[model samples]
Target: MFKSFAAKAIVPPALAVTGFVIVCCLLLYSVIKTDMLNDTIRHETNLADTIIKSTRYAMLKDDREMLRNIIGNIGQQKGVEQVRIFNKKGVVAFSAHHAEVNTIVDKKAPGCIACHAGPVAATSMGRMEQARRFIDARGRSIIAITAPVYNEPECFAAPCHVHTAEQKVLGILDIGLSEEPLQRTLATLRMRMTVFCLMILALTVGGVSALLQRNVLMPIRELWEYVSRTRRGETGLKAPVYRDEIGELARSFQEMAAKLKSRDDDREGGSDPPADR
Candidate 1:
């Protein structure tokens, strides 16, 4: 009876609960990781765009100092690692880190690699193609995005700048943002989610096991005990009633017991013998 109760009432629910918890944890983790990645990308792209808009007038007036100041100020914003303006020749025309100004960008660098597939840059790139991610020298993850500076009437007509009608792309605005802060936040959230799921799983499984033991296993055990007592000649034993297959079995047992008792009573009351012949 103990073995039967363990198998039927305990093992199945435990296995089910474990499988359910594992699947939920995996699905939740996957969703959280994807959302984190998208948010980081969007944030970096927006920052790059903001820098481009703020420095446009300075670039048109050929004011190097104003452009440097704008890029430097934006670089101080939280999570922004570096900012640069690259000319068509792949030269660092301006940079937040002043030391990097005038330095030539490598063809294989994250910011330029997608556009400069070979010796020349791609004639045009879609908005989505300008975003990339890589690891920095300090091993921190970094998201880099670029926004192209296009030639407009104001740009070509500026007295301080050279005129060019054929030029479509003037320069590229590049921004790199650190992902360390985001990574830390995600790690903490993952830990909390794991703990919460485990707690719920434990409570659910425990409640189910307890209910099964009380409603199913206990009644069956009681019926078995009642039958054993009756077999030992105990009187007045009653089979327990349940509303399932077990209940039907209990009813049959009670009927059999009553029949046995009636037969015993008849034998005990009968007259000793039909006088032999």
Candidate 2:
């Protein structure tokens, strides 16, 4: 759609660069998003480990009140959606929400399915496998991780000694956190990257266009003007100053014009225009 030579020369590379930048921006956003998510999950995993460690003594002593208070207190913290512990049988033993306690948790839920889907339950899992992203009841984005509570030596060796050595996993600690902060950060980053990419594209295209106009288009226009005046039999033609092919072409045109003018002057002087000389 461009009528100008500068547009024709500059637009294609500019468009290519634009598409490349867009793709790179999208890939960068995806990687940043994944890394941020993994970082958040790792942080939550550490928090889960801390919670398990803090409540370990209470659990070993069979102190239900203290365990409940610990879980309940953490769940009340800002950004913590919920903190609950479910027994091996998928029964909620201790939870921030009292109504959920003693209730049977759905083993098929997003947080539990990775461990419970197969015929044999998983005793351990990777950090990435432990987390799940979902929307809560209030339509807010949330990430939940299920940390398997292992049956350590202290647990089975407690005074009560209610567990066996064969028991690998004692229970599961499920913690949910809000994802709003991450989402907002990503949105801001995306906008800034878009603006930066646009600025770069403008500078690149503008620079290329300026160079083409100065070096190529200007010389060609000067040559065309010289030729147009010569074609119209105009005198006193202003020679086009060029450093390249246009310069050579202008010199040739000037020579042809001079030869024609010489033949006309000879005929006007009645000097018998030299035939084919």
In terms of lDDT, the best-performing candidate is 2
TM-score of each: 0.81, 0.90
- Look at candidate 1 and tell me the lDDT of residue 44: 71
lDDT, candidate 2, 1-277, per-residue tens: 5977878899888998888998999999999999999999999999999999999889988999999899999989999998999989989999999999999998788777888899999888888899999897799999999998999999888878688888999999999999999999999999999998998799879989889888888888888888898888898887787768878888888888888888999989989766664
Query: In TM-score terms, which candidate is top?
Result: 2
Worst 10-residue lDDT window for candidate 2 reads 268-277
Which lDDT value does model 2 have at 109?
80
Evaluated at residue 218, the lDDT of candidate 1 is 85
Q: How many backbone clashes does candidate 2 have?
A: 0
- Candidate 2, residue 268: the lDDT equals 93
lDDT of each: 0.80, 0.90
Clashing pairs in 1: none
